[model samples]
Target: MSTTAHSLDRLIDESVFAGRIYLDGEWIEGGGGEIASIEPATGETLAMVGVASAADVARAAEGAARAQREWAATPHPVRAGVLRRAGQLWEQHAEEIMGWNVREVGAIPPLAGFALHVTAAECYEASALPSAPLGQVLSSEEPRISLAEQVPVGVVGVISPFNVPLILGIRAVAPALALGNAVLLKPDPRTVITGGVSMVRIFEEAGLPAGLLQLVPGGAEVGEAMVSDPRVRVIAFTGSTRAGRAVGELAGRHLKRAHLELGGNSAFLVRADADVDQAVNLATWGAFLHQGQICMTVGRHIVHESLFDAYVEKLAAKAESMVVGDPAAGQVHLGPLIDEVQRDRVHTLVQDAVAQGAELRAGGTYEGLFYRPTVLANTPRDAAAYCDEVFGPVASVVSYSTDDEAVELASATDYGLSLGIVSKDALGALDLARRIPTGIVHINDQTVNDEANAPFGGTGSSGTGSRHGGVQANVDAFTETRWITLRREPGQYPL
Candidate 1:
């Protein structure tokens, strides 16, 4: 198959663009390393993803360091133009990108389209140079002067995950390149063919210089190398908390900068007076969108006792009607889990919860990688599924007689990424929103995640550092804040 996906009749050509690894401005094998990626839907061997050794990561980092200075010296306006052009190229290739996202990453077409939209906007903003913050040149009482400036860090190593690959990867790469920093991106092996390679082409299409962006598509060893590389000044990662801790440890040891967007068990609360219909519809997005692989997907739910049974019945019924099948079909509401491992994990969670006495009001079984859009109610607080992230289409719900209980129930989890509330009283909703311990709170809707421009990240187990709103995870990851002074006279004042 051609790199361009639409030219082929089917979504996945299976003959080309499969198992290909693009590194350091070239597509090559992992030397002695190789791994296969099978279509979870049919168990067909689609392609092989190169498994890079730690040495390959070191080479990529060296390349990034070598080209970083030149890239940092490129004029800012020209850099901005390149990014804008990249956004245009991204639009041109949306079809191929979306197809890869659907077939390889197992994202439904609608969600893939949304991911592409976010990618275009993010790349444009990341590449488009921001107005330098102006400094006030006020004449000081001590008769002093002032100055203004901005500078670039060296090389950044970006490690992204399977869910929302394009957005998360470029979320670091775009800003790093635009800010005159070179980038070495290690895209998750699952969707690197489209998420990683296509991103490189977009940058090249927009006139980015060679070596400005280097990609290393692999698994664990590469991740370790990227985070621990002495030349890689910054590391941006999105994955699990266990992995985030490992990254944090390595960063601490090496004095490297690491930005982590870890796991989340976001909660959605429905009050007694909430619009039941709206809450049920919101369930579709909050719990099952992208099959709940999102870091901020609503995995834990709290419903007022007044509406608990009614809401559970409605939500479970809606989920039961959902179509869990081929992502390319365009008629399905939900798709299969990424692979067998994730499928088994989801199944284990649901089964364990049922065994522990939680009421499984809906699906609790799996057919290969397909875990039906499932829901659970009467989840006892002690049940493992009650407060943990299932990371699948499974939703665990508990009842709360008071709003205070809702807040307590929501905050009980170690994560604090996001929380959604449904209340008839506006003030009550706002009050709960303020009290809820989460980075994002939605009052009337269940989908708490909003615009790409918004500041998004989590608290506690979720993560440290923000992903959007101009606070790049890279530069902000490891930085030293300083207070500089400009003196009018040659003599300096004492502290």
Candidate 2:
């Protein structure tokens, strides 16, 4: 793998073009025409990547289908090693990876670096799980029959989004491959330069066979086409709720296994015993991390009545202190919100929230892709910002009189992805965790931060309610279980 120019603060095209889809372990033009990619920070044209028609998707599917059997046949350790080794290669090229993430996707420098590190960890974690299926040791009086195995399901289609490009992108590819499933990854059109090409080079460097992993970059057309392909056995997606629904529908048409990490408007709780400092830190992280585009970032909070006013004060203060500018700026808090459309959408929500009686506690400025980090409190329960997902640098706050009210308010949203419960009372927090209608819960901490091995996903509109199973999810799919009987005599049994 070549070292990228390592352009930190500069935009270098590298003679790249839009619609330049990656497929079958090769970079080539799309079967159709070309499409343009742009830098969200400057609105400048990036390049024209090749556009893949449905036919090209079909070809890729056939390729994966043809190649998957042997990969599925690969042993567990070898599969796991690929991920660990990929992590090694990723570390060496971390700067290149981080730079592209910051420049292409508009994440501030520090957060982008963290994203890279987390992605590397995730890759390795996916490799370490029980590569083989967990077995059963049964106890019987006579003829004992015990059987268990995990088998690969075949080719998996991975479609990731721009916000947590690497985090979401590698989730499917790393594990699917570890489990012996060939992968066709469709990264966000904006981030191929970061984990996109760099990743392809990484797997090759780590000794993964050609065609085991492939990258296809373009718009939704190529991705949708791949999802609809019959050869695809598992579909892993991370993006908006709307898109997840669409993918689920398409997969349902074929009875395919669909894994989705979809929309999130997570809840952050500030219990009376919460450490204000820690709570403030995570709230800011949620409000501005990746421009606050994370599905699990705390978008709303139910602060205990006793701490509500003081917590809002601290939260607003933190929001105002953030620096917004070029993503390459080392000390910048949050970068722009991907593009103008998203930034404007955030702006509208802020304005609407204020109009509906939400106190504009902090933030509401914009410069190009950069929307000021904002916080809102006393928001009307019915306002869109309070009820919907604002994929921008914004947070809405409301208060609760008691633990029950906080839990009720938190679960009111249709999205049940993640919930944060802040309380010193261990029993109360555990009780809250069980009562909350979310797939993942953060007790006495922020509701974000799932590592590679952690089974991550959402419930209800938050997602399809399926556990990603992390690294083991796909490897387990690689093998299936069967019952074997050892007879002491003929038909001797305890039954």
Candidate 3:
């Protein structure tokens, strides 16, 4: 093992990776070939993870289907107990898990730490779901009783993305398990260890029954098998808008329930009455955090014409001040993109924006996968950087003369994921927020924000359905309802 790998051993139990795939009760070899997990920070192979083939996906689905009945039969308290224990395990190994996130996914400390915290919180929050009332009685005619009860959707296929892997994966996995559904998780290939394997070990240690949760990591082939399988009842996906469209199409063809949390080009609007300094600070964090890989990152800034110049200058300085380098080196405000492809995509967008007359205000340089936090000013509405989802540390600023134009520009994008409004007038901000077409809007704050208790999802191209936190959100997505009626007496219309 290399020095970083050795450090990982000290962080979590070394046995977590001994066998790559977790099927049934055993950790076994994968049928697919091996994939090298490269560390984006150093362009080095951090580890070799076994990939899952179509056969491997089939086996996992079979195992989940076989175990669904018994697992669902398990009492709600017993299920809740397992989830609670898993949450405790997450808390116990928080540092190690966060370190894995940093090493494997190139996440800076703050974002990595936040992911760990929210993932653990999801476990705890999901525990309460099993005990909540899943059904209700309805008024009926005399001598008749009617009731509706919630039931498990059976096996769920979870395909999670590389960005925010832990929280995203667990947000689906934890809740599905709580609702008595089996999960076959296919994590992003780049983050298999932290995203898929870690959760398996945690659930196993928490005494979950065999075959309830399976981790199979692979590329698109494996994902296709999992999603197309007839045995899988529900699919929860988080990734780009393009890929999400494919998943949704497949789910529709199969008539399966699909919950998708897709892409976002969220906007940050600063009103003339807003505090420029505070808005700038929030925008800095929202745009550059995690190299702006977050789906909710502030991709566009629409500032009042009065404060546009000041906001641009302050934001440019802030972007320039951000440190982009190897996350493990310490105190890095921004880190490398997940890989070269993402870096190149971000660079192309910036270059194209500049070519189309946008001013490169600050920090448009790069070294390998590490790109500096970049700011673009006076970007036209039609420019790629301003119009599309730049999933990197790049922020586009534009000035608007009227509030209607500001709202129109913010709402004009194909995405309706998140919107941020900053203003000194709280009531006015709220009023504007109500008019924004996005799923979630923040007042006096930047676009990037998430909590375990909020309805954390998007609209239109952003997502197909909500992946809100808490038990209520899970129940709606992970289960089905059945209505039953009983007649206590015979009818007078008998023959």
Q: What lDDT would each prediction earn against the true structure? A: 0.76, 0.76, 0.88
What's model 1's TM-score?
0.91
Give the residue spans of candidate 3 off by over 4 A. 1-19, 489-495
Q: How high is each candidate's TM-score?
A: 0.91, 0.90, 0.96
Q: How much is 450 displaced in model 2, in angstroms? A: 2.2
Cα lDDT tens digits for candidate 2, 200-241: 767866878767776666677877787888888888888999
User: What does candidate 1's lDDT look like per residue over 1-495, in tens digits?
Assistant: 344332324333434334444455655566427666655566665567666778777887788777878877776788888888888877887897787778778888988888888888877776545333313344456655644334566888888998789888877778778777788888887777666767876786688887778768777778888888898887788889998889888887999767778988888888899888888888779999988888878888788888888889998998888888888765688778888888888888888888888888888877878788889888777776777878898888888897788778877878888888877887888898788677777778775464545677777888874554454433344233333557656766598
RMSD of 1: 3.4
Question: In candidate 3, residue 209 scores what lDDT?
Answer: 91
Best first by TM-score, ranked: 3, 1, 2
Residue pairs clashing in model 3 are none
How does model 2 fare in lDDT? 0.76
List model 3 lDDT by residue over 339-376, tens digit each.
Answer: 88999999999999999999999988899999999999
Ranked by lDDT, the better of candidates 2 and 3 is: 3
lDDT of 3 at 305: 95
Q: Where does the lowest 10-residue lDDT sum fall in candidate 2?
A: 1-10
What TM-score would candidate 3 get against the native?
0.96
Best by TM-score: 3
